[model samples]
Target chain A: MADTSETAAAPRTHVSLQVNGTTREVDIEPRRTLLSVLRDDLSLTGAKPGCEMGNCGACTVLLDGEAVYSCLTLAVECTGREITTIEGLSASGELDPVQQAFIAHDALQCGFCTPGQILAMKALFATNPHPDDETIERAMSGNICRCGAYPKILAAARALAGTQAAQQ
Target chain B: MNTFEHVTVTDGNEAVKLLSERGGAAGETKIIAGGTDLLTLMNASLIAPQRLVNLKAARALRYLRFAEDGALHIGALATLADLERDAGVARRLPILVESVRDAATPQLRAMATVAGNLLQRPRCWYFRGAPHCWLKGGAECFARDGENKYHAIFGASSCVAVHPSDLAPALLALDAELLINGPSGVRTLPLAAFFHEPTNDARIEHTLAPDEVITEIRVPGQPEGANGAYLKMMDRQAWAFALASAAAQLSVEDGVIQQARIVLGGVATVPWRATQAEDALTGQQLTPELARTAAEAALAGAAPLAHNGYKVPLARELVRRAILRAGSVPHP
Candidate 1:
């Protein structure tokens, strides 16, 4: 017979995931969100949970190579999927150009919405290397920084766009 | 908050099977795609459905491909992020893309699906607001009597929540059709016919049966002289619904109008198609005067509520601007 505590505990199911190219399996509640799965279950806390809803981009991550809101996504559906968090963007303590440029431009203050902002920039530049100011505005308009660092954020985006294209 | 049950289906057919087998004839099931909308409703302790079926795994509902006839077929599960990123959508259906671009933030867009965006509940202060409203089957639709500036200006005899889509109007102007799947199998209907007048049915937006799911949208290729555009007037540039918006499509021949369509957004219970406006443009010359006349024809029968009387003129201005823009574009 199962233990009495186990019987009363919320039922947890096993899910196989590949985060940043490493395969791992973990047990989680069916209703548990991928945000919690990343922060709590996997101990990859790079992705923050500022707004449990999708309104805030603090918990944005890449699912199967496409950007998605981890907060709104259920962990159960993430099985057999590839996820990329801020932690995976760099290899061996190196900085991705987008993240480095954001710092150089002073694009952040509170630093809470930084991970998501960087990820949004990464996702944007990955597809569009040379987006104009208008395209950048349209793309980054969804991620908000209450600190009003938007001007610097725009500058950082332009700098990264220029650098990313030069290397191409 | 109550813990709701969840079932994930792997394909469109499986989703239909679950709806038919589990929902049965009662038709009280709720379908969830990204849960960007349904979860918000559930988290807020809104209507509690008997069962919640997840369609995120339905491969058939996640594509943005073209049909053999050059018409675009967008699966219901295609995310707004996907829509904005597609070169095809930007090149051929910028009006539709413009609608998606203006809604929500990039984070929400990445998570929100097109079908969910269209089917999402109203954001009326009385409804999403702390207090109860009639849309949730309350005694009074607060929008009827209070803070109704954003309410409907036409076809809203009872309730006044404005239609919240920027793309629906443009899509309607393009004569898009939905491919729906219910227990009875698949069927299709034009987008204009999808929305019902409040008098027709105050409780529902589309004609979709409770057990049905929108599988794909069939938007025909642009005709010989097609030109389309969307305009939205909102308090804020992001995350807010329209104050009043308009979408126009016109085809010209030998400097004379051959075909035209106009639909009003954020001013009705549905993407309000303007038949009178179409009639006014079908045989007229592509002139600023003709566009103004067509604009007047579009708002001829508007019945705006208190505090929203300006919608009639706002709608007229947007209609005129949209038509002039469409008329000036080189025929595609």
Candidate 2:
């Protein structure tokens, strides 16, 4: 019983999406990506949309406490989910472990994909404090760095993993 | 660019209600979740749904559970991140995790829902190109004769875009079930039946009703003393679709195969369940020789397209390797 006509006379509805611990309600274009909502509506530009498609992980954000590509997600779809943008990585001005590690290891050259890469690394470190080479490779495969900063990124992650192990 | 109206639903029932109300002979209404697929279609102007319903608010539709009969019930909205994070899923259905782990980046996995993964549109260039091709309700699929390297080999007559969900084949191997809900009520179908080949339904990838929303995915629990494994062969090591892949589950008793499930991915239209492979392994001793023979049996009837001929051997080899690996692992 699908509508065969191209035009629907109904009006668009407004919705609230929990974004970076703050609820933002806005009117959005039906075709707008969640990336657009976060950056344009809420003005949280921490999550960058490098590739509009899900290919590059540059637009990665945490939806319901898990990392997901924001560019490929719709704002209206995330009405009730908790989101964690790169802005949430720090409480005040203090750097998160993953961020600190990236700084320590110098894990960036041009740094466009840094936010997404750090988030991926942070997620990996949280789950697996000590990841083998294969696991690291598999986990970080999606975030591409044109600057060839993979070795440094791995080093940063390894340093944090070491610290986490020592604390344990 | 064509613009469509957007709607968001809170649960499976609400999605059905929205669809029932919106999709009534005027035009198609789309249910978008992760937007991993829908955004591409919209950007490319391929599918112009008059109404778009977003299902990410459906919390009830995003759970992993064990039903009354020991079935591993996973809500369709369960994201790849959820699958990877769930200790129970990792302990029981490691292959599901392994398959989805390569679906995209960690970011995409967190956003991508299981049902959306199953229902994601095809990745064919023609489908996403500037011109309309056959798969988009046309008379011919452009991939049929042009740039069909990534197209289907088995169960493809008209449209040949390979079903891309990596977790799908693994689920089929373990005899997964999909629970769909719509205006007509609830419907339970096998994961194998969930997706149809081009001959069965050339217009769509799955048999889900226009108003149907995939609510739950149930994988029957593995029997006692059963081991499972999944292997994917791809172009590169990261975030790439499988060139060919296979998942195998086996129950071994005193070094002989007592029960087996063999499923192939990236080789057919749907999650290709290889009955021929299972038949070859039943009651056979668990050995490299036996595993290789069973793998060969799996691809015996495989019909390959022009550019994808190598997929036949690649898929078979993956099956052999996965079976051998699973068979060698001692069951608890």
Candidate 3:
């Protein structure tokens, strides 16, 4: 437990989270969300806190290769599951294909929603390597880009779909 | 968010035992499967519980399969994304897929469970963010006369908030039943009986007791050559709740309707099953004029609030479209 004296009414539990392919331990209350643990505790700030509600997908992350809203996910419930963040996308020190596609298509402005958007696309590509435009739009509809960069984002996703189809 | 002791239960029996042992006070202990709605409500300081029983690890309650009787059985913990991407559901009962396909975002669909979606609280702005509202034990519903563009048009008792789940209406149309497990035992109830209008005495929605938990949802197969359609009209293209939606299932033979079910969503406290509309369609020929008449019958008793009169027309049009689509009737 991190701070027992601060709140004697509630006790904190030790939670082991696998973030970015590494196991990390943190003692926190059950109320702490996975987004808070990722940003404040582990210093993996790639997952931004946008609305804090599930309405906005700014805190999107991959849990067992499926994209889910981390803000709505409790940190205590993520044991034994593979968690991947935006930092994990480029673990090889080279920009992943989705990241490269974003840069090539100019898919972001102000860049607050870029990481969540990219990770959402990464999860989509994991399952459907070559998605059509409707599938791509439906998959990326969760991540809201405030800068009105949807056309470019769609272009980036379409490009990835095209390249993946070519490789196949 | 208020801190609560988190406990993990592997199955329904353990969860029931924990609830019974913990005294099973609705305000004290809460059950969480996906935490998509509960966590949000807690974040807004709506309903605070002392403990949360995590049911995500209940592997026995996370399945989706069809029984030999042609009924599709879905575990309570099955996610909306799981239903959307399921080939069997798409083939056997496509209305379920259509209902959940655009209900929420991709991330939310991946996280929200079928039970949570059915048991989720109302999305009325006043009910959600207001300090005092009738649904939350307040004296009056603020949305009754204020900012009620999204409130209910039908069945407004003390609260005007509308039901938010897109899957409930579709399930009700398919004649779904729930298997509820409690300390007493497991009992099955029709999906229609599970929901009721909120009154001054009963401030909450749904009929699930404090100690009871929904284990499974069984949707019986439709009639032979039956088809259905779910149409939702939202303010945005996606990721927003429905302003008004319609789910219509019909079994037609020789261009005549043999059986029909019409359920409307986002227009009432519960999934409003239009029996009049169903009666109007039964034994009638599939035609655009008949569809319009059925749609009119569905909204005949609607009493809309001042700001939400638009929902009546919107819902009527959706009902008409859903009926036409379900019967494969062409409309100009």
Candidate 4:
């Protein structure tokens, strides 16, 4: 249990949330963004904070299955929402299809932004399983790979989406 | 970012009650809806509120629907992604969808709300930086004589920062009204009249009082045979703010323009309504020549600052192209 003080200089709140299909709780300052809390508080550092602003998608996460910038989302506001980060993309220690495709297509180099990119691609597939190249490009536009690995990233997305379509 | 007390409100009335109870002249209590813009400003130390009233829990304020009166009613908490995907918005108000489609990237659209987009601060480098400009209670505006290529070319009341919302000009072109909730009561105002030019009060942007909150936005239905379009020119293809943008809505009958509204963005302190351009289209046959003339008329009164003379021509071409596109109706 955390004491929420009204007159404290740094106001704190007790937020109990479901992250990666598990219940988690933290007493944090109100100004702490979800990205900071995920990385600093709970040690879920898969979501990188490249540009603290929303311009960079390196801090992307799924809030209740909707893709949002974790950097701009307040930790307090996500008290009851379900958050899925890159670490939670797979179940039972197996790689998610998007991660498998990334490895198969060499979708990353330097690998700093790989988690965010994989999560973004995972989100795209969640909504549109067979997204075309254009849809993939538009959906992934927010996630910038500074290493210029866009060709591989797009290839990986196409591979995953194609597999879904072929299976259907 | 300065630490602040955070309290989640379940509804508009509760939010207003809290604000009215603890609000002061210095804006000690601030509302946080989407936090896409407010968080950035706080991280930059531009605004330091002692308390934040979080409205994300107010699910009542998150909706988009066409009312019985044929008006499109959007709650303040509706995300830009919600508007982008609504079939009615794409059909009845395609221009609104287009305005938001290219403004920010997908992730931002997912996080930013309608009210947050409408209330976001200017993207001016000077204002966002550490300079205590006129908008920040300083004596003079740094962009008035400084690097002002992206600053205002019209309606610059001692502050040349351009209004940054892509949805504002489009909504104004459609003649929308904003439903506001304050301590006194709920009231509605024309969207065009809602924005105010910067004055001695360095703490406010729109006409919203410190204790007031925008609950919903109502856009009147367009006339039959009315078509609208929005054109935004950006520095790059993705994730760039507009260099200049234009929104045009015109009602045409039998190849003749009956009514027209033209609004320009990224070149004014407010959304600049090109009355001259609208006037040029009324009661006239739609022609490329008329659009060019209307485009010229649109910039007839522009007073560009130091490095933004290029926006005059850019805005002119965008208005002309937008008018032509809006009036490009199939023959009956």
- Candidate 3 or 1, higher DockQ: 3
Displacement of the residue B112 alpha carbon in candidate 3, Å: 0.6
**Residue A103 lDDT (model 4):** 96
Tens-digit lDDT string for candidate 4 (B228-293): 999999997788888999999998888899999999999887788999989998999998889889
Error at B297, model 4, angstroms:
0.8
Q: Give the share of true interchain contacts found in each model.
A: 0.49, 0.76, 0.88, 0.82
lDDT of 2 at B100: 78
- Cα misplacement distance, residue B97 of candidate 2 (Å): 2.9
Put down candidate 2 lDDT per residue, A5-79, tens digits, no spaces: 124453444878877677778876566677877887788887887867788888888776666788777666777
**How well does candidate 2 match the true structure, expressed as C-alpha RMSD?**
4.5
Residue B91 lDDT in model 4? 93
Tens digits of per-residue lDDT for model 3 on B1-332?
A: 77788999999888888777657877688899989889888888898888899999998888899888889999999999989989999987888999999999999999899998999999998878955898898898898888999989889578889999999999999999999999989999999999989988888779988888899999997778899999999999989888999999998988889999999999988889999999999999988999999999999999999999999999999999999988878875
Q: What CAPRI-style quality would you assign to candidate 4?
A: medium
- Per-residue lDDT tens digits for candidate 3, residues A128-148, read 988988899899999999999
Error of 1 at B36 (Å): 2.1
Cα error of candidate 2 at position B310, Å: 2.0
TM-score of each: 0.90, 0.88, 0.97, 0.95
User: Which DockQ values do the candidates obtain, in the order shown?
Assistant: 0.37, 0.45, 0.63, 0.54
Rank by DockQ, highest first.
Answer: 3, 4, 2, 1
Identify the leading candidate in terms of TM-score.
3
Best by lDDT: 3
Query: 2 or 3, which is superior by DockQ?
Result: 3
